[model samples]
Target chain A: MSEQLTGADILIRALEHEDVEIIFGVPGGAILRAYDSLYDSSIRHVLARHEQGGGHMAAGYAHATGRVGVTFATSGPGATNLITPLADAYMDSIPVVAITGQVGSRSIGLDAFQEAHTWGISMPATKHNYLVTQVDEIASTIREAFHIASTGRPGPVLVDITKDALIGKAPWRGPGQLDLPGYKPSVKGHPRQVTSAIEMILGSQRPVLYAGGGIIRAGASEELLAFATQQNLPVVTTLMARGAIPDSNPLTLGMSGMHGTYTASTAMQRSDLLVTIGARFDDRVTGDPALFAPEAKVIHVDVDPAEIGKIRNADIPIVGDAKAVLGQLIEAGERALEGAPAPERSEWFSTIAAWQRDFPLAYDQQPDRPILQQYVIDELSKRTDADTIVIAGVGQHQMWASQFWGFEKPNTWINSGGLGTMGFAVPAAIGAQAGMPDTTVIAIDGDGCFQMTFQELITAAVEKIPVKIAVMNNANLGMVRQWQKIFYDNRYSATELSSSIPNIVMLAEALGCAGLRAESPEEVVPTIEKALAINDRPVVMEFVCDPDAMVFPMIKAGGSNDEILMGPEDL
Target chain B: MQHVISVTVENKPGVLARVSSMFARRDFNIHSLTVGPTEDPKRSRMTVVVDGPEMEQIVKQLYKLIHTLKVVEHVPGEAVEREIMLVRVNAEAQRRGEILDAATIFEAKAVDVGAQTITFEVVGEPSRLADFLEIMKTYGIVSLVKSGRIVLAKDTKSATKKQRKSA
Candidate 1:
């Protein structure tokens, strides 16, 4: 019954099932059968410079389109080459479906030419993977991969089909109704749990709401805003949860984490009710589990029950989808507050506002010193508000951008949060720019991280979706060195990294985009202004920052939040 | 406590990396894992026993961790997970049959009836291998090779999913 269908037919059918408009990859000999199937399909096949680039392109497309980005590669190096991007997607909670053609099953372990153990190489990076020995599983396998990649936390899934599976014919009976008893996604929030959470919220005098990326994934942004506004709750965001609440909203607090604002951190510390909606409370967000929100009774509402109390203890865990949970909460809150006066935690709100006023993201001017990355990021934030989408790579610069950049909209701030992936900002910005070409897209990258995916600059040029990349070149892996300085007692170790930082101007010119370099604090503003002026092509501005500078409010490993060492002197 | 867990995942590309990376990201130290063909040709069994205190979290994370794989916990006291070890012991020709008799008692196979030496394949849990190693050392064990732990669930159904559904 499963015969008469080759692997190619199954792949084509699966793409159709996924409604995949495009498949990005660089084809090789091993995957010719899959390529053959794609020849007549309506889905556009974009050939990239390299297989790795194909993976990035798919990731970018997914980020912009809010759809599952699809990529394919031939066997051997083609399959192995995609490991980096797969790892990137796996870390950032991006939805991507990577399909690779494999050598025949019989040739799997024989080490045939172009025969590589892709399953082994990719196992660490994907949510799950499949090597379909029989042709019948193709439709079902692809369906499951798409479902898994986009559901729950949303991550990448890889499917490797053998050449024989692709060539041998089997009767295509479409994905058989997908009746996996174990695979049902949690769509509705647990009702009794929701009631208990509402009771806690209504009882608290000083309550604060914490929302995460799950809100955006669940398409519950409006619901979040409405609920917070109705309940008079101040909201804070995780790095991924940036756009879930508008920064301009009166109740919105800035992002929280290793680089979180003092106000958000303080609010978290002092709040009586910590209502976490769709957020995982990662270690990066909650510095130490033992001391995080110590006084607050947490009510966690998330689609994935596994996330509840994973890092911090949860008082009330309502396991269900966020959108549905929010709806239930809104209804219950309305019923509970009928003809009753609302409680205004004005003192708490005033305290948070006071902190925001005192700090206000300030930076000191050094007349003759090197340009500071924080000043540059602050100026960019000043120039563009929430409408602008900002992406950043991990490092001292990423921390600075997260702290300094005042993002207003959800999906406006993109970063590799949990994985702390370097070289993520530039390509991700390119992806964001592609999705909303009308909106200004800015990528803040560090010197060491930018070079990782700088090759994608050519793709930006070709696609004509220009994204401005601001490179904070400190000539070192700043974050690692900061850790070494604090934890290793000033021993630099192997953290001192010096590589030729190409004249970003010349590189930008080479890539057919605008280029600027800021050597001092004064030049930072003009350079960013110049880059923003170039609307047609992408721009790369290299800002040389103080090498010895460190990310302030650093919570050392196994250290409490109170142990944060802010500057060089503290370190 | 550290645990060695074996996962039976559909034989596919990058599955091993996915599992190992999860352990690394979560800072879960994996003792050992072995992947090979199972009774079902299409599905490969990964005998990975991970040791950790938050076994509940580890078990919960596994469901969110994969799409097609089933994680069955086979801890020492509750479930059955076994290991196989082959040890070459230095035994005189007269004592070979006695060693073979011991091997038979343990359901072990005489892989190599070597002259002046004998190699036996013993299959059991980690403790069993330790006992066998200790007994073989009495016979002046010359060399030994132990297969990394490969685990399986005692019941046929995936237990984690059952727990989740009940929860």
Candidate 2:
């Protein structure tokens, strides 16, 4: 044990022991001591204009690097602002550790200045939270927070440190053993369950491999590709699992859900078996749980046992890490198939192919029409390569980016999926860029989403992180407008925003960023190329897209997958 | 369906709140919950009875909490359970003797006596407690309180098998 150090010093030491390289945060009164200690530490700190931005930037770093990201904020309003990103991380199962400073220990329940009941408020939003008033507990609490955040079913964990603790002294015991008896994450699937899952896979004919964000989190994309190829299985990745398997692969189907491709949606509905790997059957993906895949028997493989039967009943449940489970599944499947006849799935492939050919993710891009969002996405995709990491803010532009970008690598596509948090792209892109300095990071955002968190451009410029921002400027909340047009009979309530205010170009200039605009099809490629060319600081490009554009091949919110709408005409 | 789930958790601050909040957020209707010190001083055991279609989900939810050390479900035919009920009955000059006679049949003890009311404490299986309450109703039940249940799995050995089984 080393000489006693201040709680703030121990906190920084603990983070250093965890091999943390970067921290995204905005300093305030409550966390001033922590900031002072961090200033002398080796970990780089990226100052965000808002706590929410800091939180999301950490999430983006995790999404890009497959590591537990860290963020810091002060108490009261500062901690409250982090709620959205915490909730987002919770919903998406991203690994993030957020540290917040609380009021002094004595003033805890008295609602002292800059104090909030963040411990209670963050309980449901975080995987776990700690309120440490004692100085000796700082290291242990931070250690446990990182452990909880990065372990099974990874999610955000919060550690609220009282101001007294930050200034108090504690002996430095470097990286003590975790007293977490209840937090064991199952890594290897049970042998019997693995065998049962293999049996289900062997017995099925029209099997579709449904992958999700857990695949990325578990680093199971390679296993997913191998198993799908070996079994001749068709794969349908969800929005979060876009690049789990290469979109160019013949057996791989595109994203499935509300704005899913027609082929992927149809295949899921008709498959005899859904080999769900690391994906929860969210209501958005299921449409209606009662009617989803009526003929399919599900084999759910997840790290979290609670997720097994939460939404859809699994015929075979394998609770373990996805990577380890997939490896187990591969060996078991090969042994079972040594003498048995291979499953005949030619007809199923043909059926899926026919749907793919007929629908083919088509869009109405007439030369006469103003710049189409779909066309811009395709242009950007063409300009960028597999190494380029794409972050999307939630909306029509998000769908267009996912649908059009031919992702061939894992961790290449990141977005706010489960929580659907808008304005995630701006700070997240900066965070991703910070993590992968050599790789290009682009935020394909909607006009509405861009406006929500665009202030982060200053952070990007100040940090000299060269992330490209492509705003599909439609001047309206495209998804909500589409919903209003279809379901609400076009009331269009408070969805439209003025296009002229703080013009995108001038705003980028003010924030010390290069800005360009593309209005027609001819200007699309040149404008994206121009944005990509600038590498010293952030660049923002406005793609003037048609306001009337809508995401197609959508399944109605609560409607059955069988009743999917191909376009506006079907609606 | 109702399930009797026993969860072993670390004796930490806000642990009960973490568990209770999980149940509320997950939309589980808890019937009765009892928590106290366990054999190990560092741990506490919580006996929760909840009504739901998905008992497995309830069990999984309990196990998901970071403080939850262990979770055991006491299946209906395999476990013995008990609850304590305290009932205050209106005892007039005419009904005082009758109320005492009814309490005697339930093996209840007169814990307190007031001007016109007699409070009896009874401990038994939850159903038996309910039956005793029903009998006390004839004397006009003034007030009643029921403690959360505590349960233990039956021993495999035949030595302690009781002559009467609880419903």
Candidate 3:
């Protein structure tokens, strides 16, 4: 007979079997047993100040490391708080597994204390969820949660366990068999479709390679670079795919979107064929779907069939893993190119180069102007190591960081891309730092964003994670203020954060972090040097930036990308 | 035009909720839905009748669910559809013979007979059931319940995976 273990023990064992290195969560009344079991386990737990911070941290770890990130919370408000992060992960397609403790079995429908339908409440947000009614089901629930999280087009999954089941005894059977019959994700591209796509690529005069975060998730960066370089196709990476193709490459056209580069925006509008790989044409990327790429014939490739024709119709839809499909395309291209002239898209390249030269990403770093946020990002990019992972909170600073920082590698850029959640940088930096211990992790945040989740730094300080934070104190909600200045007639309704803000440096010191501030350009490098020297604890460096700077190359909401503004002068 | 989507799923708690919630979020127009155990105790079948465009998306989304095993959409003329209903109608002494005569013509049996009412159980095509219910309404309907709709391919060639094994 197999030995018996409590449901909590089974859960901890299953997580360990899945090689979970760390879990971010808070302990509460309902999850006491699970916490007790975790105390003696091999897995490490980082106690979070709030469930929401922990949820984002898990997402950050998943986004950075390409592994399933895990978090735990008690029922009711604790689980409800995770909904936002789960929704963010769903929209961005990150792999996160969230586990929550529910009330006792008998108290399920009796309005028990701290009880909420965790599974039901998180249904719309999570990729899948489990409501455990039996102690024996804990093993399979944990296994399936991890599987569902990391497979196909990855997203978050939730597992809600009852307190009674956690304390109840069940036989210690190792990993339970997964019974998911409906989840069969296609890997290889269909042969006929691949041939058709090759024909389109070979026949087209102006072809562009569009890549999204799926390349990083599939680890197809090498394949992407090889294909682009071989075919001499100009490549455009989205915000989520900054590192898929290095921006330094002569063939790369940087990003394409609302605040994307002028060269990339123009190239996408003029391309005759767009070979879209792993990217869903999000509204932000393609401002107006119908008028997005008027002359382009789309050959869309994605693992999810539903996303193939969800928005814009695809002339050739290939549903398969990005890496597998790219690998297939490379081999097919070699055979098809035999004895044929090597294709060279020189004319298209020259057009893109002229745009880049005319409108390079420029910022006024004049000594007369106040410390500019873009200048700080440029300085940080020059000083940081090649492997440094940059996490950004949503706002004007996010655009500035993406715009200024020369991101040339995959898995090095992390942000709340789809949901655009503010306050993601602080905890997410800590989580990424914890996941990649040898690499430097920095959080580039705005004043309004920093104040939202800087408290999570205490967890890093006490844990000695040594993540750095750079707060751009522009004295206002920069992004919203810019919008109000442009769209809302400068009313500035509730967008100002400068009226009565706390001293961020003092707040950082109070949280046991090395705090420094730079108000002038000369002071910037010295403060950054001082912050980088601190290895024992986290450092928070505040840069008092100009409030007038707004993100450029703008496309107004519901406007077509064909009419992209170049800069403030264009506005 | 309405479309019939037949899905086979594992018999488990919350499976129905997962399937129904998916439909609600996708905004699929569900005219009627029915679920019951299959020959195998571990599996169940659901017949959902939905309308509107995006018929391809309806099937694609259902296949995304973890518990779903198979999904088949039944075309209009290639499949047979039926509905079962139990309708109770008011029967007065003067109207008893007339109601009985109407039920006889429609091949419906009196499952229950109270002093003032008679419950008729009938199984037929949806249109046939509507025709029978039209005549019974003259005697006045007290209450009625229906088993939405169940569908099957006209020939045995269109059998499910499990059905093929049993055959």
Ranking by lDDT: 2, 3, 1
lDDT of 1 by residue, A1-571 (tens): 5556576877787788889887778787777988888898898776665777778768767766678988899899999988888998876678999999888888889989998988778877887677876676788888988888888667888999888778877787876455343455677777788778778887898798998878877778888998897788899888778778877788888776566777777788778889999888787877777877778889988776677768877888787878888999888878878957567877877888897887455567695998888888989999885688888888888888877777656677777776777767776777667667798989889888887878778877877878999988888888888778777898988766564557767888897777788888889888888888999899899888888777765666544555545455665
Of 2 and 3, which scores higher on TM-score? Answer: 2
Give the per-residue lDDT of model 2 (tens digit) for A379-495: 889888888999999989999899999999999999999999999999999889999999999999988999999989999999999899999998899999999999899999999
Instruction: Pick the DockQ winner.
Output: 2
lDDT for every model? 0.78, 0.89, 0.88
Point out the higher-scoring one by DockQ: 2 or 3. 2
Per-residue lDDT for B1-167 in model 3, tens only? 88787888899888999999999998888999999999999999999989887577777778778788888887677678999999999998789999999999889999999999999999988888999999988888999999999987779556333211000
**What's the i-RMS for candidate 3 in angstroms?**
6.8
Q: Which is better, 1 or 3, measured by DockQ?
A: 3
Per-residue CA lDDT of model 3 for A1-571, tens digit only, reads: 8999998889899999999999998888778889999999989899989898899999888878989999999988899888888998898889999989999989999999898989888998988888886899999988888888888888999999999989999998889888776677788998889888888898888899989888988889999998887667899998888888887888888888899988887788889999999898988889888888899999999987778788888999898889999999988887788856548767877888899999788887988678999989999999988788999999999998988888788889999999999999998898898899888899999999898898899999988889999999998999999999989988999888872368988889999999999999989999888888888999999999988889988888778888888777777
Which residue pairs show backbone clashes in model 2?
none
The number of the candidate with the highest TM-score is 2
Q: What is the interface RMSD of candidate 1, in Å?
A: 4.2
